[model samples]
Target: MGGDCESNVENIIEVKNLKKTYISRGHVTEALRGISFAVKKGEIFGILGVNGAGKSTTLNITIGLLTPSSGTVRIFGKNFFQHESELKNQMNIATAYADLAGNLTVYRNLKIYALMYNVPNYKKKIADLLESFGISHLADKWVGDLSAGEKTRVNLCKSLINDPELLLLDEPTASLDPSIASHVRRLILKLQKDRNMTVVFTSHNMPEVEEMCDRVALLHKGKVYMVDTPDSLVKIHTAPDLEEVFIRLAKGELEE
Candidate 1:
C-alpha cells in the first residue's frame, strides 16, 4: 500500500546488524551482538534495558561516537559514517553521564555549544530554552554551584541549542525529583510535537517509558529481546506492566 510504503520511507534512523566489541587488556567483551532497529520520523522511540544490556553502546554507535565492529547506520536515508559531519549537525544528545563544563556559567556553556552548532540568534535560543526549563534565573550561576536537578536541566538546555531534528536522551530524568522529572517529561513531549522531532530515549523507569515512548525496544544482554508498543508488549507477555516485563527479560525468564 502507498501509505505503508510512505511510512517505511519515513524512518529517520535505520540501524542494521550493529555489533560492538571491546578489547581491554587482551580480554574481549561483547557490548552489542547484532542489534537492529529503526526510529521513525516524529516519534519517540525508547530503548529499554538493565545495566550492561548494550543500550548505551547502541546509542553511542548511532551518534557516531563509537565505531561498530560490523554494522551499518543510516540516517536520513544516508550512510551515517559517510555523512557523520553533516548528520551530527542535525542530532544532539542529553545524558546524565555527560556533564557540562563545571567551571562555566550556565549561559556560557550553552553559548559555546550553540556556536559549535552554528545556531543563529544563539543568545535568544539559549534564553528561551532556559526559560522553558524554568531555569532562566540560573543563567548567571556557575554550573558547579547548581544542584543535581538544576544541573540536569542545564544539560537539557544545552542539548537543544542546535534545535536538532533527532534528539537522543539517555536517563534524562535520572537525578530529578518527582515534580521536576514530571515537568521535564511534559516539556520533552511538547518539544517533540511542536518541532516534529524524532527522539531516541533510554530510561530505566518502566512507567516513564510507557508514558512517553510511542514504541520501545527491549534489549537484553546485547541483543534485542522485543520491540513493540508498551501496552502491546505487556499484553503479549501477559505481564502487569513494563516493570514486570523488564524484570522477566533481565532474569532471562522470557527468552525465546
Candidate 2:
C-alpha cells in the first residue's frame, strides 16, 4: 500500500548550505559547513567521507533526527522542520545510531516499527522484508542477543518494512563480513530497482560506493569536496578508480 511517489516525486531531498554546530565547554565544533546537494528519485546517492567528515551530521539533519544550526533541508520541496509529520511518513532511515529497542524480539521490533508507520498489510510486509534480508530465523530472538551483523540486517529489514520512497543509510555494511556485505548491497539494489526508491547512503567502503552508487559526494573537512559519478570523479581526480580517488583526495593531492 505505497503511494505513487512518481506522481509527487520532484527531488526527494534537497540540502542548501547546511551547517550544524555543537558547543561543548564553549568550544564550537562545526559538523557540517555550507553543504548543498540534491538527491533525485530512483538513484542511489552516496556521501563518501572519512570519520568525522560531516557525512553523519548531514544524514542526521536530513532525516529529521537532528537540527541544522544553519541552512535548510527540504524534503519533497517541504522543510522537515516545518512539516515533520508529513515528511516522516514519506521517508525512512536505517542508521546504527537509531538503534531499535533492545528488549524486543526481531519480529516484534519490525512489527512495532511497521505499526508506527501505519503500514497496511504490516505483517506480510514485515515477513517479506525479513526474508529478503535473510533474517527470518532471528524473528523470535531478542535484539540484545543477536550478533552485530544480525542486528544490522534486522535494522535493515525494519527500515524496509514500510518501503519508503527516500531511504537514508549510514554505513549499512560497515560491520558485516565481505560475503554478507555484498549480499546486503545486492538486496539494496534490488529494492531500489523494484520500487524505484530514491536512496542516499554514506560509506567509507570505496569499492562498495563504486559498485552501488550512481553518483557520489566526497565530504572533506566539513564541506563537499566533489560530486560526480565514480568513473568521472576518478578520471578527473584519480586516473584509476574510487579507491585511488579516495586516497588522493584524503591526501589533498586531488584538488578541483
Candidate 3:
C-alpha cells in the first residue's frame, strides 16, 4: 500500500469512474457505481468482496468482455475499447475451473492456445511452462485423463504461454490442496518478479491474498470501499489478520 508516489509509479491499468448496469426482463441491476482505481506495473493486486459485490463486473469490463455504462478503462495508457484487439495480445486471463477441451491432450490444447496468441517458439514455451508447473509428464495425456489439480496446473501454464504483460486470474488456486496451492502462489510471485508482470486477480482466500498480493481493494455493493495493502488494512482496522479485517468490512462492522 505504501509504495512509490502515484505520480512516479508506472500504472498498467487505469480505470476511472467505471459504471455498469444490467437490465433483464423488467429488472434493472446496477452492477458497478463509479469505481475508480489503478494497478501499477509489476504489482500483484487483489479484489475481494462478497457475492453480488460487483467484483466480476469490474473484471469483465477491464478484460473487454463487457462494456461499462460510463467512465473509462485504459490499459498501457490506451483506451481499452479503441485498442481492444491489439491490447488483448498483451494480456491473458485464467480461471481455476477452466474447461479445457476434454478430448484434447494437454500439449494439443496448449498448442491451440499458443497459436491463437501467435506465440513465437510456442513448443519450447509450452514445454518450459509445463516443466515449471511440474506437469510436463502429463503433456501427452488427454485433459479428461488428468485429475482436477492437474487440469488447474495445465490451465495456468496455458495462460502464461504468451508471456503476457498482464494476467487476470479468477480463483487460480480454488479447489487445490494446501500444498499445491502454496506452490502455485509461489510460482505466480516468481513469474511476476522475473517478467515484471502486472497481475489483478479475484480471490476469496484471505491468507493467499495476504501472502501474495501487494495491494488489495475491498469492494461492496458496486463500490470500492477501500484500497490498500493487506497488512495496512489489517492494521487500520486493528484486526489480528486480513481475514478478520475482511469480515469486519463485509459485515458492515467497519464504517467506510
Candidate with best lDDT: 1
Query: What digit string (tens of lDDT, one per residue) describes model 3 on residues 1-256?
Result: 2122233238888888888988899999999888888899999999998878888788888888888999888888888999998999999888774579989999999999999999999999999999999989999999998888888888899889889999999888987889989999999999999999999989999999999999998888888888999999898888999999888878988675
lDDT of 2 by residue, 96-196 (tens): 66667889998888889888899999888888888888887888999999988888898898778777998999999988999999999999999899999
Model 1 TM-score? 0.96
**Which regions of candidate 1 are displaced past 4 Å?**
1-7
For model 2, the superposed segments whose C-alpha errors exceed 4 Å read 1-9
TM-score for all models, in order of appearance: 0.96, 0.94, 0.93
- Highest TM-score: give the candidate number: 1
Clashing pairs in 3: none
Report the Cα lDDT for residue 230, model 2.
85
Model 3 clashing-pair count: 0
